[model samples]
Target: MRLPRFLLAGVLLAGSVLLLTELFAYRASGAVAFSIFTSVWLTLSIVNAGLGVFSAGYRPSEEAAALLPVFGLPAALAGVAWWAWPDGPTLPSPRLFWFLLAGLALWAAIALLAALLIPHATRETALRTAVAIFLPLWLALQVVNLLVGVLIENYSVAEELLILALNFVLTAAMPLAASRLAQRG
Candidate 1:
């Protein structure tokens, strides 16, 4: 897929995920922290899916070219979120910024490695491989973030696990679904 199409898919999917979560989960729970967490998760998922889809059938160098926007979209969104977040006495804006930066850096490194390792694979294969590699790295980061108190408590362990599972499914499935549709057209 082309870069613009990849980016458009990422944004649309991210927006849809955010809207659905806000409507179904956030509204009922009424928890700001949970909403933020859900948004971040969905944004990152969009990045991962976009990276996989756009990098398929490309060499490492070409994949590298696609990496910036794939990573940048979520990072930019996160930055916006931080900027727009309500400033209260308890709000640690600087810390949140650094935390987000760190997460983005880690994700970029992992994604680059995955892309290079799976270079020039078939669309479905490349996306599946990327998703397999990314899911663990993402889950590990989430665990670390939770343990380090970067992610505030808003849901139970069971709920978090469910969300994680759903994330994995969506992240893996979306690219494959898009690729199939692209093939038929």
Candidate 2:
């Protein structure tokens, strides 16, 4: 599919997600909202990309190229905003770190399962398959890193500006990384 149309669809999906999540009071706090939003968005983006590969006969590279920017932009924005906000997002407890690590394996396994389900997609190189599968998944969690902008916590306006900047950077970077991964094989 053309990038513009694909992007429009992604935007629509994101908007719908935001609306529905809001209706459910998902944004009651930054942590809760980001978790809900990222989890849902990640699953949808990955499944959609996987479908393109399995059903539409698209290359892993093509799906990766389209998927990254389409999903990463808003995620990065929300992440940076969460960091810059004064109380700095009441993050999950440190004890949950192991759980997250386990979750990453689960994410990868699920992605691998998707590739396995589509026998044709499995013909692609391991790296290519991984890039397509994990790019969106990694991008989904991009908002989590917003916790690192320790200095920006006190500056709301600066945070907003950083959010915009980081969004652009991620929008550009994700596609570039995907393209790079696509090129590797």
Candidate 3:
């Protein structure tokens, strides 16, 4: 299950696109909206990276394994470009930044755990299992952000739906894309 270079490139590109979308969505909305979104993007990016790493482990090559985190670094740089530069938007507190990183670490750990568990499970079931566990936890965090008033901006329902759709496409489609690429290679 080693992923081909093109497939890895696709996954990285797709993940970067999704992260940029979140950053743009936040910038479009306002501060409260940005705050709420901050953690969500980090969580998803971490999970995406986690999944990539987990999937890469299937083939166990030093080259592929080395590329795992590199795939995610672009998104991080993108975030820094969008959020952390001088003369960029200032926020209520820096605490949210730390929280987002923590969330990402947590999700990354979960992905590693899922990767470890998958070997004992059937191949047919592992991807489904990973998705099942990931989506719920992700949604729940978003809901909590809204409930806690972190997402204070007035977002249209359509906007929410669009974000959800973008997230779904990125997370759900990645494995299929990787699977196809792996098979072909």
- Candidate 2 C-alpha lDDT tens digits along 1-185: 33444344434433333332332232454454456556765775787688878888999999898678756875665555445542333334442342234234433444344444444553244335655665565444434333323334453556645653554354435434644665665
lDDT: worst 10-residue window of model 1: 21-30
Question: What order do you get sorting by TM-score, best first?
Answer: 2, 3, 1
CA error at residue 179 for candidate 1, angstroms: 11
Ten residues in a row with the worst lDDT in model 2?
17-26
Put the candidates in lDDT order, highest first. 2, 1, 3
Model 1 score (lDDT)? 0.46
- Provide TM-scores for the models: 0.32, 0.36, 0.33
What would the per-residue lDDT of candidate 3 be over residues 1-185, giving only the tens digit for each residue?
42343234333333333333343344432333333334544454444455545764533355355445543444454345455432333334443443343334334334444443354654335444545665576556545444333346566656665555544444445545533454455
By TM-score, is 1 or 2 better? Answer: 2
Q: Rate the local accuracy (lDDT) of all candidates.
A: 0.46, 0.49, 0.43
Best by lDDT: 2
The TM-score of candidate 3 is 0.33
